[model samples]
Target: MIEANTPLLRLLRTYWPLVMLSLGLLIIVAIVDSSGDVILAQTLIEGLVRIVIVAALYLFIGNSGIISFGHIGFVMIGAYATAWQTCCPYTREMFMPGLPVYLLNNSHHFVLAIFLGGLLAAVVALISGYAIMRLSGIAASIGTFALMMVFYSIYLRWSTWTSGASSVIGLPTTTTPWVGYAYAVVAIVGAFLYSRSKWGLALRSSRDDEVAAKAAGVNVFGQRLLAFVVSAFFCGMAGGLFGHFLGMLTVDSFGLGMTFITLSMLVLGGMQSLTGAVVGVVVLSFLIDILRRLENGMVSGLNLPTSSAEVFVGIVIILILMFRQSGITGNQEVYWPFKGDVSASSAMKRQS
Candidate 1:
């Protein structure tokens, strides 16, 4: 520990300039982001939502070294939970006319409903993680994707609860742009904190090589499960806000379409870097918005076909994967301090 700390302390002193630059950029992003018009502001908040979700992915995929194709299931569950709580049903005047006796129909409290939505997702993750984590490589990815598909099928058929494919309308528009941005910042900070914690190290070790890590007494299954479930919780929260923000949600938001879009954002930034995920969400989301605008706007000669945005993002992802296979950061991060690099080493050296 002492030996490592000396090198870490030296690195911190060595790279203070980089540290300052990063902090300055973050402050600027927060300030400028908050000052935009409501429409643009909302878009920015949505960007933050993606940032948080992608950051969580970085933790699991980046640290635990597992790719999840269907984690959107948690978000689907979350969107419905919040939508059900906040919307007025035909029976209850509060909900609509009246809610079922046991359904807990009030969604007025923003903090509570959103947290509950996230919690519900986490609970689902707890169960799902156990089953899915048992698999490895492409097998685990396929298994998780299957789970997402199964959930999607259920949601589409469960008209009594999810409103099926028609659409879930009347979700109260209480999720503000600010709240979304706040949560995004929290997610980024939290992910950074988690990935630098002791558990993160174990998770990363597992990702790098489960057999080797396990040989050192690491619990690979547990690590992957822990990382994945945490990521799922935030994804659910992001979805809940998404459902409410638009004042309605469709099953499609939590479908394969969203799964790919969000994953593409993460992939474009970098599969291995938390920084990459954050950047990926910010940059790709804006590009997507631009593509959406182009699709909506008539071209110089003719109107573009519908769904062009999806096509564009898909192409972008393909190019990124082809050209930049290491993923945004190759599992590297800017916070080398907490990453147990020089910072941790410095502490150990000081103690020594």
Candidate 2:
């Protein structure tokens, strides 16, 4: 029973963007391609994880009025947790010997490993939330960022445990495009439910005006903690899925680069609207694809070479931030044009 004029989402279903037809088109594409189609499938699957993580980020930041640069740490933690599960002690005996004795020894148990990774991430967030949410503004961001740096150092230096810089191998990828899209659906729905729920409203109240929301009986810290925990859980799940999809991972993959990229997506799409996050990830992903093609041409045939496609992405981010500070949605609903219906819905919602 959740409802909102989620603009990009509703617009995504329209005929013009062709988004309404993308899933079907991709399905056909997957079916038609037989040779090394797995690569294409893997890309799509990882994109799904990105969508979920971005959605969760929007949910938390939207409600809590907080910014985070450490969500990627959750991804790193998840990757290591899953990697340890599939560590293959005999092959890389110098590193992790095996998972704890209580867990499955097979190491290739994809479902179990992924579940463990997500759970581990949630647990970390739950613990960290208590400490981090106690602060406000830049303090919270800086603290969580320190947490990520500490985790990164541990993963990099603890070679005996995480195999240091050597890529964790022997992982079995169970992620697919279908699996990714399913997650995006679930995450989007979950974010919608959260935005419409009483708890979500309380958090949003705090986001809009902390003193006012506190007067209205919302424990601001508690609301922030709850959002952080929920956000971390989904982010962790996305990270686990990503780990298995690539079948290879390193601490560097979930670094500040990822943090900046996702934050850019959130900003470009609209921080207050989950629809914005969806749009951002899709647009950015496609942007990356186009830049890669362009870069390929430059390097292969044209003779001029570029350092990184991310430079192009960075430029897009700067432009979006400069031109649209409130982002595309600007705290407005997609169907705000439907004044009568939207007003009624708002009135009924307030009454509820």
Candidate 3:
């Protein structure tokens, strides 16, 4: 058993493998990108952004065993919030003229704008979680989906603020592979720490057996809310990064299509494991990119239709689910050779 007084250093040591593996993958990608392959670099940035978003999803969905379709809504909020703060005065004046003087007059730094964007999503999550967390099973899932629709509708119709359904242009193209790599590392560390923390354990317990967890005095609702808000914050930051990466935003970018893609990535990776989230995003993103290139006739002599990539992805998801419903990693973390005995002992204790 881990002692209550276990040193922080010990905890950090236990999770070092996870951190190392994550960083190692990013380093390999960075090296390849250094060859000046712009397409590869963009793909790496997109993969890193997906990693951040999927990691956020894992924090809540993995621990709580809840599926939330509304997270993309938070991403939309963050992206637009970042745009509002970072766009030049002239751009904001022309596109979003209804803004207050503070937002209209000042163009903030990218870092500050991204931070505020994440914070904004967190606040929204907290407010919505109060009511949504009360629900469970399919009801909670539906409620979250409804929340997404609400966000989508509001952003689509709020013409003065969001430019309605039209794409919002003039965002700074500031997200590079290195910037994405740094954020991805931070997100991995945060997810790892939280997963090993007491609250995360409690939430997982509640997820596995709500009745027993409640009987043990775990505040399931509160724990779920905490996870939800934390997840939203990182996801929002990812949205900010994505907006800057693309230099544009539209309701379609954060709508059902995006939600489906991100959720598919999470599910493919083993939604219950942090390592799975990273691996899933990296593998699927690369696969999609390759398929897209093939469709564009970059490799082979045959040029397939644009929809071929989507078709292939859909088929892959179906096959994976049919074979490994729990995902590529199941509920296990990445392998740490020296910690085998420790993990075995913990499993024995839990069973007894």
Candidate 4:
């Protein structure tokens, strides 16, 4: 057992990974804010949001070893949920007549709306995951894809609730860089804590060997559902941030393109560790931004086609897959610079 008088250095060493990630984010924020480049700042803000989402995905996918194709569905639910409560009351009444009287007649605070949106998404995950988590392997992946399609089709046809393919505008532009950074830090901490929890360990055990984990008394499905719900909550929160940042929404934005890009980020970052999630988003976001500038001719002397960014990312993904299946992080996290008894430290942390 750890003593109450443990040195401050020891405590910091125990959580150095979290400290490192948080400080790294702060540095990024500082640099971006000082750049005075609105477009660059926006790109970083979006990248921070992606960190929230990809971190959420890491909680489940990394621990469970299951590739999910439907998390964007939860993101969709979150965006629409926030939009319903926070959009202009007049606009909601006019565009979404199917909403109840309270929804149509009143507006909610953006923070509350974002929280509600996450809660709603979590509830949906609880309901859907009850069924989806029962399946395993490729079947489970297919189930999630179907779920995404279901959300898309429902939102597309249900004009009353979602404006039927029309953009839902009037969201408060409140998701500044700091807000995004704060949430990203929260997500990283939450993910790290979860990874260190008994539930996360059990899920990973099942991921490695289901029969062995089951023999070891792990309730695999229950653990999976828990991860799913928690993951959805953060993804939903990301959706809320995204909507507020853009000050608008469209169902199409939450479809295959988003699903593919986010999954790619996760896979590219090595999907097996928390470090990979953040690293993946940072690396890919910067690459995309550079490619976008070239494509848009923001940088003189070079010009590319409109869709060149996507093509380049695709090529990068292919190269990474072929040569570095474990991604740039090699399925590992950033460890403390000074090596010590990591196993002992991990055990102590788990005990605490």
Candidate 5:
């Protein structure tokens, strides 16, 4: 018989929630790959990419009870950063002549470039968040929105570097379903670890009541800034994956349209819970895929406009907000259902 007090059993009891989520994702990926359908597989990869983005958003917004409209700006920063290191050297020399000689002359591996993209975005977040995180409530949200707009305008006008409203092509198409899946898993684990960390708990305390958190000796601003930087890192990596997946980058692709859609997914999924983020992405992605097919006339005798999916998604969001404000997961994490002593399960968790 298995020993109940053994380390292995304790580990399992502590992390059963993560194990279950990971297995569920793996099963979905396996089924899709087994079908041998290229279009569906491609869509699956895209959905996984969104999971990374939405999960990163949840790391900050969910824990801090803050909304951000400019996180997509970090995504744009990361995409072009990857483009700089992974795009063709010849294209760089011709179109992005303003790039430093080192970058213009050499191209790096996509994996290295992707990581560098995230690092650069994190650096930007560190700088901007220092100021933005000082503001609370809606002011901070507006600050992020402004940051995104500033990024959009700069990228739009920076012709010699970002192609100036033109598409930056020749990025190696290296993002396969497996690659996307790996990154998505990494994102989930990273978010979970952070959520359980002391910093995460402190930030959430401040989120719920800033005054009380301050009375308890928490560095509210510091916690917010830390979460912001970490969240940006994952978002930037997602942007790199997005660029490679499509083999092209455009400023317009990272604008308001993307910002709103991602925010909508986060809110729909229950911005206060990580499980909600993943579930929201999966459900909405599936819905969009079906709606897209209908829009493309997949069904005989059916007519739908090109933007029907967006309209339908908006309607769904309205209904969700009106009926279930806490989101589908009710702001709750997936827990070990068999555990009779829930406190013991929590106590068994080792601090990261």
Candidate 6:
């Protein structure tokens, strides 16, 4: 039997598996970097960003039981926000001449830029989530998809601010594997803490039974909106990291393809648990990388078509959903010492 402990200690106990998994990935990244493979290093950086993004998704969707397609809209906003604050003066002047005098004239530090980017996205989420969270089920999902389309259309046309369909260039590229690793750790820890918090419990209660939760005095909409804003903050930071990683930003980069990819990662890993998000991203990322190698004839004599990776991923997703809709983790987290199933009653009591 487990002894009663402080919330912090219990939180750590419940999430130690996730923490160790992240540390293990960081070690792998270090090993890859040590091997002097710049290409692998870059790919790992990309995977790290996906881990952050998917973790953000889990923090909101997993706890709240809401599926949002518009989270990537926050990502777009964050990327351009970082670009506006960090891009060179000449680049801004040349591409975004109509920007405010303060933004147009000065470039900020990368850290500050990332913070502001995330802050901006969080602010937007706060405003938008008020209405969006009031919606439920497929309607809520559609509302979010509409929000994404609106953002996409505006970014595609607002040339002065977003450079229209063109890419925003000349931003600093300072994201190393270490930096990505740091953010991934932050994402993992932050998500785990939130999942075990009072608000998280209340949200999950509402998710499981809205009528009972309402009877118990839970404010479902408020909880959902709170999660939305917090999730957007991390997603925004992911976007900023992505911008700095690639040193470029385009509206299309955060469009439908990105939405589907991240959602797939979340669903494939198990949408109900944090471990699912991390495992899903790592597994699928490596799978895609391996398929890409095969496509390039790097693996034996097999030379698959350029689009084979996507096809394989789609097939795999279908198979997983058909056989195990809860994903690889089956809506359960990875616990320490032994991989045993955790019941909801125990989790709730521990949080209490």
The local distance difference test score of each candidate is 0.73, 0.72, 0.86, 0.89, 0.89, 0.88
Judged by lDDT relative to the true structure, which candidate is superior, 3 or 4?
4
Ranking by lDDT: 4, 5, 6, 3, 1, 2
Model 2 TM-score relative to the real fold: 0.82
Q: Mind giving the per-residue lDDT tens digits that candidate 3 earns over 1-352?
A: 3332347645555876566656677676769677898888888888888888999999999999989999999999998899899875678887888788899999889988998999999999999999999888789899999999999999999988888878879888998888888888888888888988999999999889988999999999999999999999998899999999998888778998888888888888888888788878888898988888888899777888898877887888898889997788775677544443456546767899
Judge candidate 1 at residue 68 and give its lDDT: 89
* 181-297: candidate 6 lDDT, tens digit per residue: 888988898898898899999999988988899899999999999999999999999999999999988898999888988899999999998989988998998888888888989
TM-score of each: 0.82, 0.82, 0.93, 0.94, 0.94, 0.92
Model 2 RMSD, rounded to 1 decimal: 5.7
Model 1, residue 177: C-alpha shift (Å)? 2.1
Q: What is the lDDT of candidate 4?
A: 0.89
lDDT score, residue 44, model 6? 88
Runs in model 2 lying further than 4 Å from the true structure: 1-42, 87-94, 103-108, 298-304, 331-340, 343-352
Off by over 4 Å in 1: 1-39, 89-100, 298-303, 328-331, 335-352
- Model 4 Cα lDDT, one tens digit per residue, 1-352: 3332358767776677799889998999999999999999999999998999999999999999889999999998998998888886667777788898888888889888988998999999999999999998889999999999998999999988889888888888889999999999999999999998999999999999988999999999999999999999999989999998999899999998888888889889998989899999999999999888899998888888898988888898899999998888888777666645455545668799
Looking at model 2, the pairs that clash are none
TM-score, candidate 3, is 0.93
Runs in model 3 lying further than 4 Å from the true structure: 1-13, 344-352
TM-score of 4: 0.94
Mind giving the per-residue lDDT tens digits that candidate 5 earns over 1-352?
A: 4433668777775676578777888998999999998878878988898899999999999998889998999999999999999887666777678899889888899889989999999999999999999999999999999999999999999989999888888888889888999999999999999998999999999999999999999999999999999999999999999999999899999988888788778878888988889888888888888888899999978868899999998998899889998888877777655544355336656432
The per-residue C-alpha lDDT of model 3 at residue 319 equals 85
The all-Cα superposition gives candidate 1 an RMSD in Å to the true structure of 5.7
lDDT (tens digit, per residue) of candidate 1 on 184-214: 7667766767777888999888777879999
RMSD of each: 5.7, 5.7, 3.2, 3.8, 3.6, 3.4
Q: Any runs in candidate 4 off by more than 4 Å, and if so which?
A: 1-7, 343-352
